[model samples]
Target: MILVTGGAGYIGTHVVRSLIRHGMDVVVYDRRPLPQPLLDGKPFLPVPFVVADLADRQALDETFEKYEFEAVIHLAGDIVVSESVAEPEKYYLNNVGGGMSLLAAMRRYGVMKIVFSSTAALFGLPERVPILEDDPVRPINPYGRTKWMFEQMLDDYDRAYGLKFVSLRYFNASGADSSGLIGEAHDPETHLIPLVLEVPLQKRPYVSIFGTDYDTPDGTAIRDYIHVSDLAEAHVLAVKYLRDASESRCYNLGNGRGHSVREVIATAEEVVGASIRTVETPRRPGDAERLIAGNERIINELSWKPNYNDLNVIVESAWRWHKGQN
Candidate 1:
């Protein structure tokens, strides 16, 4: 069985569902309540779950004792960039501390496989166009720094404790499951695509563009958005790789293309069939100019291919899911 931490969250929900569909008996370990799908809703798939924080060592011990986990997919962490800046301690506690607690449990139980949820924010201001897996990781924000620190801890654990791990550095995970049954429903959403999507949802009047003087073609930061389902698939593949491989690895998950803020809005407008209003402002602190991914490593090694690469298709999937919400 695979134990998915934060399996009730936005990305976790998708990843958990995908894992179960792949014929893997899964146990969801999340602090939040189990989502509707795992809780007797439409298209329900009964799953064993525990509602407890990763920081709770007693909870972690009991969970490990109960479930015969072959591997673990750790997705429990704070992800908001702005919030990470405002409260660095909170990010450290959950992202770093929580990760350490989970690792300790894994070490104690002799469970050695882990697939970490890292981020492209590990690059501060990119010295290269499409960042590579072996680039100099200089995280600017607390969130990125925490992820980087966790990756380093994973490396240390590999040598000291013999833990096999795969750290996936995701670049702008967008879109939703095509079924629309599970989608991005983050409380206090901060992702650009979803925030812009709010305009069409009638939840907000206009979207906020944080930076306009960026060096990109549209003077806005460009990001490569990999579909969430694609990312979830990569985690499964990574788990396979870690299980058979002898060395720890890291890979970037993305569309291998760039889309600026204006481009996202334009594509979203085209998808929604309505012009979304935008209000430009100064760039948020720790914001990078352009962070696109060079995904050849994962593609070549894991045979990972993103099925949803087009911006319109990505936005359209999100549109369909959000439109269903209201």
Candidate 2:
């Protein structure tokens, strides 16, 4: 059976759905209570949901004791970059401290494999465009620093013990399930697509454009936004690769296609049939100028082909999800 930490959140929930679709026994451990969509009555409900925090070692030990989990996809970590900057200690506690606790639990049990959800922030201020996996790790924020620290921990664990793992450093994860059953729903969403879509839905007053004078074509930041479904599919493959006893690997999950902030807003307007009010603001601290992932490794190694590569397709999927929520 596969255990998913933080599987109740936007990305983890989709991972659970994809794992179930692939006929894998799955259980979700999330600090937050499972939303109504993942509840038993929903048609698109995935696997069993268990509300547990990885930060609590006792709870994690109990969970490991109860399930004969062969592999675990660790996604339960504090992710808000702004929040992390405000409270670096919190990120360390949750991302680093909680990660250590989970690793200890896995050691206590015989669980040998893990697929971690890492971020592109680990490669802050890329030395070159299309950042590679081996790029020097220099994170500009606490959130990215925490992820990098865990990667190092994974290496340590691998050397001392025989804990094999895969760390998928994702660029920018957007979009939602094609079926619109589950989607991004954060208390204060920071992702671009959803924030723009929310403007048309009147959920937010306007979308903020941070740094409108970058060296890009549109004078704005360029990012590689991989669809959520595609990311989930990669996780499934990562789990399978581990189950096959493959060596520990790292893959960058992205479309290899870059989209500017202006282009994203324009596409969102077209998809939602309404213009998004915009406001210019000073560049967000620690925000990179441009980030486009070098997905050749994942493409060649994992054979990951993103179906929703087009910007319009990405925006349309997210638009459907936002409208459904209304």
Candidate 3:
């Protein structure tokens, strides 16, 4: 059986569904309660769930004891970059501290395989476009720093112990399940695609465009957005790769293409068939001009291909899900 930490979250929930679809017995371990709407569907309703934070060592140990997790997909961690900057301690305790507790439990339980949900923010102000895994690890904020720290710990754990892991440093993880059963739903949504979709949904009056003076084609920051399902497929593939191979690996997951902020808003408008009001604002602190992923390594190594590589497809999927949420 596979255990997915934070499986109730946006990306983790999609991964859980993909794992179940691939004929794997999956259990979700999350601090947040699983929404009933998520389980109101077909394949996901019967899946098991454990509600506990990763910081609680006793809870983690008890969970490991209760269920024999063959492999773990670690996704439970604080993700808001601004929040991380405001509360560095929260990031450290939850991301780094929680990761250590998980590792300890994994070591005690003898579960050697894990797939981590890392981020591209670890590259910080990238010296080059299409950031590679071997690039310098200079994270600009606490969020990226914590992810990088956990990745470094993973390296140490692999070397000292026999823990084999794959750290998938993902670019912008957007979109939702194609079926629209489960989608991105944060208390305060920060992702670009969903935030733009909210304008069409009438949830928000206008979308805030941060930093419209970046050195890009449209003078807006450029990013690589990958579909959530594609990311889930990559996770499954990483798990298979770990089961087949012995060495630890790291790969950057993305569409290998760049889309400016203006382009994304244009695409969202096209998909939603509505004008999304936008207001220009000063660049948020630690905002990079551009950050695209070098996905060739994962493509060649894992034989993974993204189906929803087009920007329109990504926004369309997100729009459908967002509209459903209304």
Candidate 4:
């Protein structure tokens, strides 16, 4: 059986669905309450869901004791870049220390394989356009720093014991599951596509165009946005690869295309059938001007191909999911 941490959250929920689709027996563990939508009237295909904080050593031990988890896909942690800057302690404690706690528990239980949900934020200000796994990691925010620290810890663990891992450094995950059953649902959504879509629904007055003087063609910051479904597929592949391979590895997951702030807003407006108003603002700290992933490694190694790489396609899936809430 496989265990998923943070399975109630956006990406984790999608991963759980993918795993279930593949006929895999899975258990979800999260700190927050199991989202009602995930368990709504689904008694026949009952996927075991548990709410337990990873940092709590007793809870972690109990989780291992209850389930025979052969593999783990960790997706738990604080993920806001701006918040990480303001509150570094929370990121370090939750991302780093909490990850260590999970690792310790997994070690104790002899669960050797893991597919870590790492972020591209570890590549703070890239020296090149498309970043690779071998690129220098100099994270400017605590969130990225914490993830990098965990990657280092994993390396150490692999050397000490025989722990196989695949750290998939995701770049700007957006959009929703094609089934529309689950989507991005952060309480105070900080993602670009979701925030832009909210403007049409009056959830937010206007989207902020942060830093409109970058060196890009649109003079605004550019980011690679990959669909959540594609990311879920990558996680499944990582799990399969880890089981076959014997060593730890890392891969960058992205669309290989960058969309500027103006372009994204324009696409959202086009997809939602409305004009999106925006407010010009200064650059947010710790945000890079252009961040796109060099997805060649995963594509070449794991044959990972993103199904929805277009901005309009990504925004449309998000729009549908958001509108479904009403």
Candidate 5:
């Protein structure tokens, strides 16, 4: 059985569904309760779930004792970049410290494989567009630093203890499950697509464009957005790759295409058939002009290609899910 941490969250839930679809026995270890109305209906209700923080060593040990996890999909971590900056201690403790506890439990249980949900933030300010796995990692914020630190730990553990790992550095994970049963739902939503769609949903009056003076073609920041299901597929492939191979690997997951903020808003407008009001605001500090992923590594190595590569398709899927919620 595979253990998925943070399996109740946005990306985690999608990955859980994907794993179940692949006929894998899955168990979720998350602090949050399982979301009601499981996405694909009653089938998801039978999956085992353990509610506990990763920092709780006893909980981790008990969970390991209860389930024979062949591999772990680690996604439980502090994700808010701005919050990480404000409360570095929270990020370090839960992200880095909690990971250490998890590793310790894995060592005791003899579970040797993991699929980590890494981020492109590790690249920081990239030297060029289409970031590669070999790019110099100089994370500027606490969130990115914590992820990079865990990755370094993974490298050491792999060399010393034979703990195999696959780190999938995701770009921008957008969209919802095609089934439309579950999707991105955050308290203070920060993702671009969801925040933009909120305007049309009447949740907000207007979406704020952080900056319009960027050097991109549209004079707005550009980012690569990958559908959540595609990311889930990559995680499954990574798990299989590690099970067969001895060496650890890291790959960037994206569409290999960058879309500006203006372009995304325009696409959302087209998808929802409503003009999204926008207000230009000054660029936030450390905001990169463009951040796109170089996905050739995953494509070539794992034969994984994104099915929802189109921005309109991504926006439409997100719209459908968000509209259903309202």
Candidate 6:
């Protein structure tokens, strides 16, 4: 059985469904209880859920004791990059400190395999386009620093104990399930595709484009936006890789294609059949210029491939889900 911390979250929901579709037993542990609206009639409904923060040692111990977990997909962490800068203590205490609590419990219960949800922010400003897994990491924000710090802990744990891990550095996780049963639904959605979709949904006045003077063709930052389902599939493959007793590894998951902010808005406009307004703004701290992914490593190793790599297709999926929400 697999234990998914934060399994009720945006990405966590998809990952849990993927694990179920792959014929693995899953139990979710999150700081918040599972939202009933998310699973009232979904195909992968009724997954065992444990509601508690990762820092709660009692909750972790009880969960570890109850479930005979083979591996863990650790996704329960503070994710807002901008918020992390203003209140770094929250990021450290939750992302880093919470992770320590989870790791200690995993060690105690002999569940040493974990698939960590990492981010591309660790590569603050890459020296080249299509960043590689081995690229230098100099995180400029507290959130990225927290992820980097947690990854360092994984490496140290691997050396000290017999813990094996697969850290997946996702570029930009967007889109939703075609069924519209689940999708990206962050409280204050910070992702570009969803934020742009909001203009059409009448939720926001205009899409804010940060970093308009970038070196990219569109003069806006370019990011590799891999579909959410594609990212979910990688987690299943990573757990399988570790299950095979393979060595600890880290891989970058992306579409291998870069889309500028203008391209994203254009795609959303076409998908929603409505012209979305936009405003140019300064770059947010810790944002990279061009963050296309060189995902050959995961491709060759896990035989992982992205089914929805096109910008139009990616935005269309999100449009379907968001339209359903309204």
**For model 1, how does the per-residue alpha-carbon lDDT over 85-184 read when each residue is reduced to its tens digit?**
8999999999999999999999999999999999998988889978998888888889999999999999999998889899999999889888876788
In terms of TM-score, the best-performing candidate is: 5
Itemize residue pairs with steric clashes in candidate 5: none
Clashing pairs in 1: none
Stretches > 4 Å off in candidate 4? 38-45
TM-score of model 2 (CA atoms): 0.97
Judged by lDDT against the true structure, how good is candidate 3? 0.90
By TM-score, is 1 or 5 better?
Answer: 5
> In candidate 4, what are the lDDT values of residues 78-135, reduced to their tens digit?
9987788889999899999999999999989899999899989989999998998999
What is the lDDT for 106 in model 5? 94
Where model 6 places Cα greater than 4 Å from the true spot, the runs are 37-43
Q: State the C-alpha lDDT per candidate.
A: 0.89, 0.88, 0.90, 0.87, 0.91, 0.90
**Model 2, residue 238: displacement in angstroms?**
0.5
Question: Highest lDDT among the candidates is held by which one?
Answer: 5
Please write out the lDDT profile of model 6 over residues 152-256, one tens digit for every residue. Answer: 999999999979999999989998877777888887688888899988899999988888888778799888999999999999999999987658998998988
Instruction: Report lDDT (Cα) of residue 244, candidate 6.
Output: 71
Residue-level lDDT of model 5, residues 147-188, one tens digit each, is 999999999999999999999999999999888877898867
Off by over 4 Å in 3: 38-45
lDDT of 6 at 79: 88
* lDDT: worst 10-residue window of model 5: 37-46
lDDT of 2 at 118: 98
TM-score per prediction, in order, is 0.96, 0.97, 0.97, 0.96, 0.98, 0.97
lDDT per residue for candidate 3 within 166-214, as digits (tens), equals 9999999999888877888886789899888888888889999899888
